[model samples]
Target: MRIFVPGDAAAIALGADDVAQAIQNAAARRGLPVEIVRNGSRGMVWLEPLVEAETPAGRIAYGPVEPAAVSGLFEAGFFEGGAHPLRIGRPEDHPFLKRQTRLAFARCGITDPLSLDDYRAHGGLKGLERALAIGPAATVEEVVNSGLRGRGGAGFPTGIKWRTVAETKAQQKYIVCNADEGDSGTFADRMMMEGDPFCLIEGMAIAGIATGATKGYIYIRSEYPHAVAAMREAVRRARKAGFLGERLPGSTHSFDMEVRVGAGAYVCGEETALLDSLEGKRGQVRAKPPLPAHVGLFGKPTVINNVISLASVPFILAEGGAAYRDFGMGRSRGTMPIQLAGNIKHGGLFETAFGITLGELVDDIGGGTASGRPVKAVQVGGPLGAYFPRALFGTPFDYEAFAAADGLIGHGGIVVFDDTVNMLEQARFAFEFCAFESCGKCTPCRIGSKRGAETIDKIRGGIDPGANLALVQELCETMKFGSLCALGGFTPYPVLSAIRHFPEDFGTAAHLAAAE
Candidate 1:
């Protein structure tokens, strides 16, 4: 009998370890022979510590399980797929899980991340195999044809980025995976690394071939100890398996990668800042024109991509470009693993096509507020993402649609807030977050953030509320235009949106008063 429990951080926090131990004890006491595997979470976090029993029917899920319920579960013959009060039926059949397209996250919950055999058995290296069979030029062309874009906030075409590095003349080029997922309510990168590490490994390797980069580095944050540990072990296993090191078997091309940890600096999530940190320098954003593609990582041409962007390459290669490209609508292209968190009933990872509306995601898939109160607003993208009111619920999840509405689908983190949430406080928090995380590389972000927060405070305190609101808006405009990176540039999205959409939270219209 095979029984599975997640070993990922979220599951661990929910007492999965205790549950696993209890399951083991119960099985031992019952003289039942069972194989226990610690897999990654299915991304259904609210139903965490999700235990699965493999039977003739399929993997039967029972979640939010406690140690105390282990004996009861065992007695109920859950291992045999018997009825249980905690049974969630098939996790895949759940409404939240059914709607997703799940390209990058295909193997996330299905395989043991560290087991090379499990990875291979579940169609893991097919993309790399196909890429190797077709060669680098074809692989690059396939990526370009797939219409894939960076899953990292920028949404730049991944193929074009790779083409730039490929065409660049350089003695030493690099493939850098930005795994420093610093955005609040976002865990797609962490989940990918900790779940199906080999998928990322294969994707990076394919990137190495396509871009002519010989070395690769995954820049993950230090806060994710589990992910870091998993990636390190995965690298070792990959090297031993001939998936990495000197040169891949049957090919003259060579590529190797290493894990580099950042000091939990939010700024390091930025591509330029990440490169600086990777090179053992103080993490800071670099100026454009000499983009990372041309001058990056020790003054060499580099192909920097977010984990999901790189991970998506394998699928494009394996299934043909058009197959993956067909999933999304319009210019968005392919599936996005959207992470739902904060005040939502069914918070987890939902990877779907780009055409879904905000109302559908928040109300349908998310099941509204966890408190059962009316949902007031949703912060799409991340802390820097704009607050979308109920009136804008019809806005589609596509990149162009969001951009047209002055929004950004940054890393696909959607944070929900109930009616009780104060939009003014959220707006102020955006500036405060920027002030705390800014690298202090530019004057606009460094000083503007503090000024924005202080101004918002004055409005909240009812001291010249109208005038102070105007000052905050002015300060936001300066930061948006003058900041060196998205940190400062995007902080205004949340602030301005809050003031525009929730005027009641700010107590009277400051702009109206200014006109008077």
Candidate 2:
């Protein structure tokens, strides 16, 4: 019997390691032969330690399982594969798994990511095939029509960025995948890199094809050691299979990829800083206008896209652009792989077409907080993202709606906080976090953030509380205008949002009461 089990970090942490070993032991004692393939996560993290046994109908899922239960599968004749209590029918049939509009994540959980035949069978290089046939201009048009934007906070149009690189006449061009997922609660990039390394490879290849770039780099964070291993293995597999490297199957396009490990800096996720780091220099932000498209990566025309943005490309090439554009509302076309995290009841990856509200994502999908207290505030985007009170929960989780509501969906990282959470403390942490993580390139972000933290602490102690509040407001404004990067510019979102939304929580008496 062929059994599929994921080796996702979260699943392994939940004892998938023991479960896999147990399954092996069960087969050995039963005198039954079993083929176990450890695949990447399917993104349904809640159902992790999810084991799948191939049955006559489809792959049956047995999830969140314990090692002790492995013997039961053998007694139940799971290898011959009759239904078991742990069986949730087909893996695809689960509600959370079923509702997803998985374009970029198409090959994520389903395929043996390393297998060329498996990837091809599942519509993998059909995009590269089509791109090789139609050529670059047509490829760019399809991307433009797809209406896909960068999943990274900026939300820049990906197609337009590609066109700039394609048009720029240069001897060298580069394609960089910014996979340094530094946002507090965001992990879509990490999950995708870990779960489906090939999709990212394919996406980068497509980006190279469209823009006439010969080399690519995936800037993954050092935090994800397993993902690094998976990506490295995938690269080896791709080159061996002729899916990557010179003369990619059925095409003359010669492209190569390298995985660059990040130094755990949040600001490095920004394209400019990422480029600086990639160039073997201190990760400092460069001024814009000579954007990455024209002058990037050692003075070459380069295309730098977020992990999700690049991963979405293969699907755009395989399926028509119109199909992708059909999903989302307004200009924010196509599905977004929204990462739900922090104190959330059903926190995991939820990918859908744009248009859902904060209310739906937080209450309906998340099932409220894990603590079961009333959710006090929701941090949309990241540390730099705005913290919306219950009043703004009605706001749609889209670019325009969020901006109109005095917030930014920076990275689609919705960190839900319960009533027990202190907004003032959370606000203080935001400044503290920025103070530590800021790249020290600009004055407003470098100095203002540290001072802001000190100022917030003074307010917490009721040491000239009214004066401290005024100081914070002034500092936030200065950072907003004076900072060159979002690190400083958007820090004010969390600080001001907390002050504005939960005024009572910031009072000295309230702080004293909480301590008592």
Q: Whose lDDT is greatest here?
A: 1
Model 2 scores a C-alpha lDDT of 0.86
The runs of at least 3 residues in candidate 1 whose Cα sits more than 4 Å from the true structure, single-residue gaps closed, are: 511-516
Predicted structure 1, TM vs. truth: 0.98
Q: How high is each candidate's TM-score?
A: 0.98, 0.96
Q: Which stretches of candidate 2 lie over 4 Å from their true place?
A: 80-85, 508-516
Error of 1 at 426 (Å): 0.9
Per-residue lDDT tens digits for candidate 2, residues 1-516, read 888788778878889888989998888887888888777778777778888888787788887778988888778767655667876667788777787778878777777766767878988788888888888899999999999999998999999999999999999899999988888888888778777788889889888988999899999889988888888988889888877799777778888999989988888988999999999998989999889899999999999999999889888888878989998988899999888889888888889899998898889888899898999998989989888889998887789999898788877899998998888898899999989988998999999999999998998887988778878989999999999999999999998888877878889543443354
For residues 40-76, could you state the per-residue lDDT of candidate 1 as single tens digits?
Answer: 8899999999999999999999988999999889888
Top candidate, metric TM-score: 1
State how far residue 71 of model 2 sits from its true place (Å). 2.2
